[model samples]
Target: MAEHPAYPVGLRLTGRRVVVLGGGQVAQRRLPALVAAGADVVLVSPEATPSVEAMADAGEITWARRPYQDGDLADAWYALIATSDPDANARASAEAERHRVWCVRSDDADAATAWTPATGHSEGVTVAVLTTSARGRDPRHTAAIRDAVVEGLRDGTLVAPHHRTRTPGVALVGGGPGDPDLITVRGRRLLAEADVVIADRLGPRDLLAELPPHVEVIDAAKIPYGRYMAQEAINNALIEHAKQGKSVVRLKGGDPFVFGRGMEEVQALAEAGIPCTVVPGISSSISVPGAAGIPVTHRGVAHEFTVVSGHVAPDDERSLVDWPSLARLTGTLVILMGVDKIGRIAETLIAHGRSPDTPVALVQEGTTAAQRRVDATLATVAETVRAEDVKPPAVIVVGAVVTVGPATAG
Candidate 1:
């Protein structure tokens, strides 16, 4: 294999004709980026996954509403083929080259020219970490390790504002989905010492009951589907307080960077030369599912899994999710933003040959006393959730491993 030219900047696709070949959640996620990048986004799929249809109706993208065919790459600058079909991705990968367009295989990009970079963004700065297996799956793990790295970097000697730190501060640590015990020991240490605390409204009100009586607790929680504080502003408050040399903790609901924008906040601190550190929280992506008695991995049941956010739709219609690979995979699938896209996600899974009757569990407010697990299969999970009105801050676990609850004494 040859080295492709270094990416121009962050993995943002501004002003590029990126063709997304799927209409599922992952495609929904990548599609928004293509549009945000000023790409003349054209989605090639027979059906509009709900997210895609919404984006299309909102005029965020152009829709072809068809499967990949010959000349689908006609005049395309870059092609991202993300179908549930490995055969489709492979075929698309081959066709993209013949048309002289840059192509990315959603599952095979690492071996090819297109790759998604690790992204961290803030008001003042943005950092993207891209790796090609030369360093292994650092990009995949970056999402996991990035928070800790930025936190230390912000507070370590690397940042600026050299002075006698004197004000009360807090570390906005993500408590991960719901297991207070899952918190990084360091996060627990800081929370134990907090003079004042700010936490997501979605989290347990009692999670902070351990704080001293004199400690002030503020609910910075954002109401779902309603008005809320801009997350950046919340981050700014944490940094400013720390600048006063005060111990501050900006507690997030789950893995901060996963979908909560901890990366953006850390980047802001780095640029401002403020002191900060990230404490890894047990991500809801895994914990929530686990709390539901679903082992994210089992010896014969599953060997690997993918965690993706349901926060936003992708600008590129093509997603990198290899349905064939995933279907053939022997690992459980845990979705963080699972509730929001349950219908579309299940649709795609079933469409791609995954058994519609495959067992799945959606755990709401996982790991806490308020947690509830609704069990069903891929075919019925979405409808069941709607009927039950199960909400977000939930984890959706899909696989045969979910056939019987992992903790249910099979």
Candidate 2:
């Protein structure tokens, strides 16, 4: 006779006692979600992975240093059997059954009465997938489906009207390094609920295009450029729309605080008494070079890396960059918005103390499908830039680290 299909339901494990009978890979993967769900997890294992040990040290979960013993599942509401030793796992599962606690067995799913479903959450909605039938399908297929559904929800392809709430406020979101997929989950969720989005040229423009038709999209680059006119207009726009009960999203590329003038906007909004929330994005200073296979700070090659904006010419009296001091550093140098001033910047570095033979890499439109890299020595980089016609929105890396290893090459 065949067994009946198990009934699927959500478990509210908040502050509930949960026992994990192993501290290996399966336990490592399951611990995070259990902790996140507010479960008081007790892990029983003689030895554990470094990560599990770290969690125990951090007080997120209680760890039993010794092996699992009889009555270990006493008073436990839920238990997981995931030990490498089959005998130990079987004993733990049997004990859990005696205590009337639901048990999940990683070793033999068919033998276990409870089945863990593939789960994912987006914008306050949790999605769980499970195969109740005895025909053993792959879990990877279920995970892939879960991922696709989550992506659709995040990118606005899948609509859940109840999940969206348009509160009057401003969100300063970092769009990450040019990739639409790189935007943070919270950022994407807020964007989906936004009434208006004021976006920069370098932000995740692809995401802006995916916004609902009713949502207003403003081009930040097209806003009038002046000492204060453009910025004031933006501030006023944010305040005015928000005051009218519209949720505004101010989206920029990379981290808003990293040379993105995010603080100024925050101050401006505060002075006007407009509510604002900041969602940090991935900074391109590191991601751009990394996209081109460059490590800003390698263990043996470079101990530190400095990121600077090269929009100003090296000889410009108004420029604040300390070129001579930078040239003296032995670590890596990453320059943003420096394509046009590469010639002068290179000249200044060489004139100071940096070697003319220093390896240099120019990554253009990094982290995107249009990404390209130009590699050359400091002395010849200017010529290479001109010959290759390297464009703006590029990252310039200088130091021996460029050519030293598998990192960004020169």
Candidate 3:
């Protein structure tokens, strides 16, 4: 008999009983989706993988720790017959069939009442692909098609112009630490939907090239100490574009609130009576140090880590940081935008009681192709920066934690 085309319909499994006959790789892969759908999942397996066991331990699923017994699918709305033993799987599938419950069999798809589709999601849409030919099943082809559609939707390449919804507002999106892939999913989606993008000198610059031609890209040269009142100009631009009924994105490097003046932009938008959304990005404060093989806080090394802006010298009246207090603590110090003033900052820390021999690691262009790490001590960091010709957009880590992981050649 020829295989009939499988009817595709989403099952609303919320609060429904889902019986999984095996807790091996197949069950481990499928359980999360079941749990996410709010299904009451029960597993009947003599043994399970560590990951599946962890789910049972975390109260996400009920584990029977036994073989599939008769009537296991009596109350189940749906069942997965995936036990290693073909006999056990067939028995469970027959029980499901008798109870009128839909079942999927990992070992025998044709013997099951239901088939799992290759699924991917993007921006509120779920893409599920299935190939139903009995002798020509190609899961890889289905998955590839799913991935292509999802990727296109995510990057705005396959946008439906007729059904596009335009949201007019300013969004402060943190693009993450210099890497496009490091950006948050929401941030990337907002950028795809943006009509006007005002981008900073830092953040994922490569993403700009992927935008549709209709998008107006403006270079926000808000480089540190470059121009006075550049932030005011950016704020005004955001207000102006949003008032014109355009979706605007202020793409900044690292987290917008982490010394990126994100709150100031929010306040400015509020004063202008315009709506704004702030999407947090991965901060370089800790990520950069970790990327350079330095943990901000290590076991028995440093207990606390403090992130501070080194844009201003310690002696500068505009500075609000307490060098003496920071020096007294034996925690890690992560400084951003302080490469130019590192010499003065190091001296201040030493004068305030921090050891001159404290290890320091400067990660430049972190999380990007141009990334490089430079090592030094508080006493020689100034000279190291000078000798190495390290530029801006670097994260400076200070503490014994810098020496925790395998040392990277500076």
Candidate 4:
């Protein structure tokens, strides 16, 4: 990841009055980084934390202990805000834009023209994790990710391909876990184009808000974890709507192929002679483990991965799987809908000679904005989940590699 020579590097904020218009932990966290980079950081807020005041008292940073002024951005080459107030952050972003200054709006990364990477330092070895949403992209998510990365400095791990696509038509978009914004660009684009939006109830309401107002939002919205319409009814509706020349968006919570019946719908669409596309959204199967800070694949931990569905009734022959082989495979195993059948599934594996204490990560709402992860050994996962009341739409990852989640997840 080299930069072009013409590209600007970090600004020379050293000794320059770089204004920070907030006083919370974000400011506290950024202050040390700014100082380490030699920026003369001036915190301007009505209040601050104990650490902030401590820094200001020891000549570590300067403070403007009053309300923000009209021209707070004067002589500021760089600025940042963490006011926890949307309107204030908006004003700060607008002012920075007007001043033609390099700014990092912590609250709204999308509004800023530039950003800071998630950097980690260990005994003079510093590593920074950056993303495509680095500059003027989804900054809020990036910033939060950056912060999490920094907090996990001691646990610096290499990155892997999450596998994203930006094609047109419906991707059976897997909105990761509960976070609507986690949906891929391709998935979002299809939603915008959908004339008829047929979604499962598990799909978040805020995510659906991205659709055009006139789009017909049909809630064939199945909640497998909860209860709703029959599967045949939902599949038929997809064909019926697509046949009408309407761009049908069959929205699934996580990647459609992962227990979401995305393949069935695509097959049905093909049979109906409707042009269909499958956008591979982030499946909660793997992503849930990730959301819980567990990696489905890790060096020496797990080498291969298999995604399976336990939601399908065992009466269906296709639902029957080679549990014995799976138990023998030296790889990570992610099971969707295996939560309800945790006992039977685990028993099958154990009977097939798999270890009883294999690490299992149970993630609810996998990658969504609001996620919950429960780490337990294979021997106790079923009981742990029941005790936690962990619901469906959750992912159960099994193997040695999954142990990394709780330690790695923020």
Q: Which candidate is the best by lDDT?
A: 3
Query: Model 1 over residues 1-410: C-alpha lDDT tens digits?
Result: 66544554454456667787888877877777677678888888888678889998988888888788877888888877788878777788888878887776667655445666655542234555556344355555766555554544333312333265444544658786666667765676567666667788654355687776876676665423335456666666667667766677778877777777788778787777776667777777777766777778877778788776544423226555555556555567777665877787778777767888888888887778778888889889878988888997677788877765544311
Work out the TM-score per prediction: 0.53, 0.89, 0.91, 0.54
Kindly report which residue pairs in candidate 2 clash with one another. Answer: 293-408, 294-408
Q: Quick one: how many clashes does candidate 3 have? A: 0
C-alpha lDDT values of all predictions: 0.70, 0.89, 0.91, 0.71
Residue runs of model 2 more than 4 Å from their true location after superposition: 1-5, 133-138, 163-165, 225-228, 405-410
Weakest lDDT window of 10 consecutive positions for candidate 2: 401-410
lDDT of 3 at 194: 90
lDDT (C-alpha) at residue 164 in model 1:
59
The per-residue C-alpha lDDT of model 2 at residue 18 equals 95
Weakest ten-residue segment in model 4 by summed lDDT: 153-162
Model 2 global lDDT (CA atoms, 0 to 1): 0.89
Candidate number that wins on TM-score, 2 or 4: 2
Better of 1 and 3 by lDDT: 3
- Model 3, CA-based lDDT: 0.91
TM for candidate 2 is 0.89
What does the lDDT read for residue 338 in candidate 3?
A: 98
Model 3: pairs clashing at backbone N, Cα or C within 3 Å: none
Local lDDT at 109 for model 2: 88
